[model samples]
Target: MPTSKETSKTATFGVKNIGGINSTEISISPGVTVLTGKNATNRTSFLQAIMAVMGSDRASLKADADEGHVKLDLGDETYTRTLTQAGDTVRAEGDPYLDDPEVADLFAFLLETNEARQAVARGDDLREIIMRPVDTDSIKREIRRLEERKDDIDAELSTIESRQRDLTDLEQRRNSLREEIGEKREELAAKEEEIDQSSRDIEEGRKEQEQFEQKLKELQSTRSSLESIRNKIESQEASISSLKQERNQIQNEIDELPEVPAGDRDQIDAEIDQLRSERQALNSEISNLQSLIQYNEQRLEEEDYEIAQTLAEDTEGGPSDTVTDQLLDDDEGIVCWTCGSNVDRKQIEDTVSRLQDLRRDKAQKRSELKSKIDDIKSEKRAIEEKRNRRQQATRRLEKVEAELDERDSKITALKQERKELTETVETLETEVKELESEDFEGILSLHKEANQLEFEIDSLESDLESVTQEIEEIEELVAQEDTLRDQREQVEDELADKRTKIDQIEADSVEEFNEHMDAILEILEYGNLERIWIERVEKSVREGRKKVERTKFELHIVRTTENGAAYEDTIDHLSESEREVTGLIFALAGYLVHDLHRGVPFMLLDSLEAIDSDRIATLTDYFSDYVEYLVVALLPEDAQALDDSFDRVTSI
Candidate 1:
């Protein structure tokens, strides 16, 4: 015999009644075979019997049978199971259950109610109804991400190492530069020391020079005054010679005039001696004044040189930017350099005026000294004439004895006056010699200034070199810092690329889920559904209260009205007849899959009255022809609606 191709052909499965029927058997076959009986017949009881055989323990048959059992046979295998008030037990032997676990599993799945079937089919977790493979691509992608992370870390480590090397090099360079700077500083210090010594020597030299200049000025001033005095002395000597010649001429004339005038000559000599004494005293006073004037002029020259040397010693850089000319130009408004205070122009003017007055006083004193000298000469002349007159009178009177005594007294006074004059001239000459001496003061001062400046320059240069070296080192570090930043940016960019790849992989995984959903829709012939989706509902917000509802899946469809308007509706809102048709279709598909896979060729169904009585038997016949095996629950009227082809239906 040819192997039956029909899904319901050549399979024997057994059923047991646990509630209404204690024991019963219903045979399943292909082709239309109707079950016909009265209204109260146990056709529904028989359907529950089949459910008990399939592994559903919830189905309770109304039979008085003491026990329930189901036996099934495929050509190459047989299976059996039993049910009781407590539970169901399944056993199979010599069947293809080992080849397909899905087949054995389908038997249990088919026994569920339409609601339960819908729930399982639409569930997000469909492990019970489907097989899923491990996501190898995701694993590989994760591994790739880890590997990329490791690579990035390795790159960072390299960058850090390079930076460390750069730092080391920079540090070494910094140290070297510092060492060089130190050596330069030491050299500069030595140079500064040399310059200091030179400056000290210069300062001492300046001091000596100042002394020399001062002494030389004094000597020059004294020499000038002495020469002037010597000129005056020459003039005095000439006058004295002229007076002597005149006196000699007068004496010759007198000698020619009278020999008898010895007494008179004696008297005249006495009076002339007295006049000479007075002239000598005046000459002495004049000589003293000249000496004082000469001394003062010498002192002024010494002071000028001393002040010059002192200024040079204190001089800063050759000459101050401030000039004597500027000071003199603004003498009327001169200010002190050191204190920024005004010099009081009146004070300076007064000082200048006083200096001029002192010069004028010196000139006056010289004139007065000259006048005194002239007066002394005049006295000498007068004395000579008086001597002449006295000699003439005495010689005539014979009082020559008295004239001799008077002449001796006059001689004594003249000798005293001559002594004072000689003393004054000698003092003036000594002062001139002293002023002419050479001494000076500015060399040492310049040396000291140079030394101080050199020291400061050395110190500043040392600090500058050190700072420059430090700046160079800092610049190197800055370069290294820039490199590090660039490396970090590159690493970040790489990481971003990796993250983008990861996102792409995740998107692909979601695509796979969508593809799997399409496949499920195709298998269910549910292409007309408005939307079908699966989710684990976290929360359902309704009527202003958050009601948490965990629904695994949902199927939504749009129904069309007779007026041709379409409206979205859920399976729960469908008419009973439509639900029945949907449920039947679902059962038919499941049974076909199970049968094709060599599972027990059986279906267990209940609650079929939603279809009209006329359509009832037709549905039964359709199931019987469409499937290899089926067990349907119905009233006798429903069974009568089936055609007469259905046979061997066991009544409870």
Candidate 2:
């Protein structure tokens, strides 16, 4: 049991003779609560009653019962919906809690739609249907999918770019290696004759060349190691510098943020909510009054026209005195045929005056309504502005709070990173400094030894070159040239192949239809046509916006213009009529751009006059992509548009 105040806050429900349900009453909690029962135990029936209270006509009486009733108690108000098989209609009475007609549509798309239910039952993600990035979540999802594909292409392009860079570096290294090998071979050839001049000299020169080669390898290795260490030291120093800069920036940002204080958020929210409810009530009243005024004006116009026409006909047929006599004799009084009301001669005489007075009264009432609406609007506006001010303050405070949190987190991260970098920089700098100081003497000694070895080698090579020119045979040089040609051919082939691959990768950038050529084949992945989102990615360009030749479209989807062809695509898979309908959707999307978050549009078609009935079903399905409420006056027998894809089909 709850206190009266707490009890009155809950919604209660009662159901009787609905489907297999007999009589049951339940107090629904404020939040999500489940009702468990075995199949065939009226669980669905009870649930249907709850849906009914929200304006879903999903309930019917049991076959044996003549009538069914669902009663809902929302706080202090109660509403009842009576279901009768005789009339095949749901008649709602009392306070159904739904004063606004708009709310009735809320649960309709979710609760009553079997397709939607099946989709959910299959465990499909509902975000695609619920997100407001666009009125149609499908469109947004399609765009997201297109982005994924574009990213995949970009990944491939990145690989190609990286490979190209590698190829360029390899090509340069290959050229340098060939140059070094060629120079060494030329020097050896030049010394060949001198080596043949004496066996002792030849043997001594061979030993000297071997030793020089060994020392050269050692020197090269030492240099490479030194360079590696220096690069590491430099990299650490750069990282430390960057860390310090970033830390300073973050600290500055943290210092700039203002401190925030607590506010009376709950009270402010309550006031705003109360003001909004009052405004909603005022809006409903104003809408009702406007509707009444419109209806009254139309009725008056029709009444006056009919009365004038009837009076003319009556006057032409009979005298005024005779007509008056006939009216007096009648029990129902003068049958004012025009207005369909009882009126005497006096009433007829004052007909214009009466209409004028009634119009004046209605106009005055409308003015008063407008004035009242203005007052309510002013009040609501003031409340909203204050609420917005508070909300802005709250947002600013939250932003500052979040910034502070981020600042703390980032500061901690920066401090740890800075410490690690500082340690690394210190260690590398010490090693580099010690190595530099200690290696100066060793490097100088090695340089002197290297110069002496080079002087001896040069003298030996010079003597060998002169002797070789005089006595060496051409056969050896010819054989060496052949070997070098084969090696050069092999190197050239590798370099050429790499260059070709790089070119191929660059060419892959222009493959406009490579990924999207199969979009039409892929479009058949989802549902029948009543509601759908069609996506087409025509082409994607990876390059930044520049003066480059690329396909005009990046991502394209089905589009329609009003009564126009549906596609701007060069490759349209749908038929001409389909494209036309799709074009109409584009037109609708453009027209309803302002009301995108309001859900689907309301469209009226005067029989879709130019369209043929053979493609009505297709059009119906296509229309669902754009229109929520479509009023198309078409001959059903001819149309047959209400196919199995449609949820409900009614004929009059």
Candidate 3:
């Protein structure tokens, strides 16, 4: 069960030309405040004034006034609202207590035409009213986002696990490279010692030997340069191959993207704009028709003396009797207030009724147009998404192609340099061979062995350096394993909660309604009434030629006969008082279920004349327990049965 928060602030309302009230001011405390008055004494109008300042557009402007204002002072804050007649509809301005008052209007404002109260009386779908505040589409979108995040996390964890499996092999390869480099250094030192001893032995031809050694050194340098060029060529080839593969993949993705015809989006946008314009025009026409109908109906019912006299004087060559008589006589034609032409009362009424029908028809047409516009907008969004994906793929493909071209050009240059270096090495080797007389051959062999040993050592050291860096990177990734797992667990829990949110709301609403209905029936003590409860049932419904299963709120009524026998009954058998009580209880259920009391402190009630004064007082008292401020409008006789301790306002 939900409980209302308590407050001690007093609410003061200042009103001018709103609803049926011309102007009024009232202040009520944060408890039960009863407005006691006869009909047309601005009791309901005062309630409307409170609603206007509370951020609701349902309040009406005075028929005779062009503007209205409502100001509310609660605690230390003052909120004001201005209503001005704008052609056909009332335009509201200024700040209010709430930015959006949808929940308040549906649940907290318990006026005569409240949807929750009327749904029960009309036997409409109760589940739809209870779940109106929950946005199922938004919930589904959130679920999709969470699921995508979880998928990404899973993929990252998989990569981390795979890298952990390679850790041991990398360590072993790094150790091997270090040992080979150490052995190669020792061999190079021994070969250098041999070269020094051999060079001393060739002291007799020392100059020739020195010249031959220099040529051999040039040949070794040329060979090293040639090897470097070959290695570069190999690397460039690998890079070019990888880039080509990537370019192909991106091209395939672009090819697979959904095809959206050219200019389709622009055409759809133009259509949606045209439809919106038509709908707006229809709305304006509907508002004008409604205002005209309301003004004319009020004039006819109240019989304004000034309007009647004007119409009487305008009737030329007709009865010159009293204006009241002329207006009252059904057989005589009176001047039309709108067109300034003689017209029968019945004929004018028929025209008004026809106008009302036209308004309804236009309203329905506007609704259909709105739905169509939404469909077209959705289509345009889908087309835009496809176009974006294709554009991204095309950009990636172009980048990969450019990179491949650069790599190919580098490989060509490297091959040409290698060809020139190879020729230079051959020429250097020929010169060294020619300088090699049979006298200093041993010294030359020692030098060549030393050069080979040094190259091997350098290669081994480079391999060792690369292996060590990879080991460090793998260790870093392994450190984050625990943190990634924890995040995955948290996401899984959140996903589960979001998935079942709607189901929980539906169950809670049913339970709340049933429990409260039983308690209220006991308190009211209707002799034959046994119980009135709502059951959540599952059934298949037809939706656009498809049968889908849905959950519905089923209302049940039970009554006991005079012979002490209980039987099930339909809602049609319920009396007016019983129906009214049931409807109010349903509204109360929604209020608690939606937790409206936490935000909207004030609850307004009116038009409870169907229920007796005693029951009405009990209902009011029951409702007061759930809200900080409870305001009810009742007649003088009905107000007598309420608690004397409650604050009462007899005049506006």
Best by TM-score: 3
For candidate 1, the 10 contiguous residues with the lowest summed lDDT are 126-135
- Which pairs clash in the backbone of model 2? 193-468, 559-582, 560-582, 560-583, 560-584, 560-586, 561-583, 561-584, 566-579, 566-583
For model 1, how does the per-residue alpha-carbon lDDT over 1-652 read when each residue is reduced to its tens digit? 1134325446565554544445555555654434444433555445544444444333443323434566656565455555433222222223222343333333323332333244333332322222112233444455565666657766665665666566656566656656665665666566657645644554353444455445444544443444444444444555555555655555666555444435654665566566566656554443344333322322221222333333444654355435534443453554433343446556644554454345445544544444454555555555566667657754543343344345445445545555555565466545534433232123223333444444444444545565567557655655666666666567667656655653443343334334443443344343244333233233464544666653222334565566667678766665565455444444344444333324444555555666676655545655555445555655566766555555546455
Model 3 stretches with alpha carbons more than 4 Å out: 1-7, 193-205, 258-262, 278-382, 437-440, 457-487
Per-model TM-score on C-alpha atoms: 0.31, 0.23, 0.85
lDDT of 3: 0.82
Residue 487 local lDDT, model 2: 54
lDDT of 1: 0.47
Error of 3 at 79 (Å): 1.7
Clashing pairs in 3: none
Which candidate would rank higher by TM-score, 1 or 3? 3
Cα deviation at 157, candidate 2, in Å, is: 9.8
Highest-lDDT candidate: 3
Clashes of each: 56, 10, 0
Model 2, 1-652: lDDT tens digits are 1122423245667888765567878765432222332223444455556555544443445545777788877556566777655443334444443344232232122221222222232333222222212222233334444555545545554554555445545545545545554565565554543333432333343434454434444554444344344444544555556655655655555445433222444455555566566656554444344333322322332233334445645666744655555544554344454565556544543554454345445544544444454445545555565656655655655555565565556556655655665565456544433443231334334443444444445444544554444323333443354555555455455545544542332233223122222232244221222222333223444666644433221223443556644655331444444333433333233223323224222233322324455455544554454444443434445345445434221311
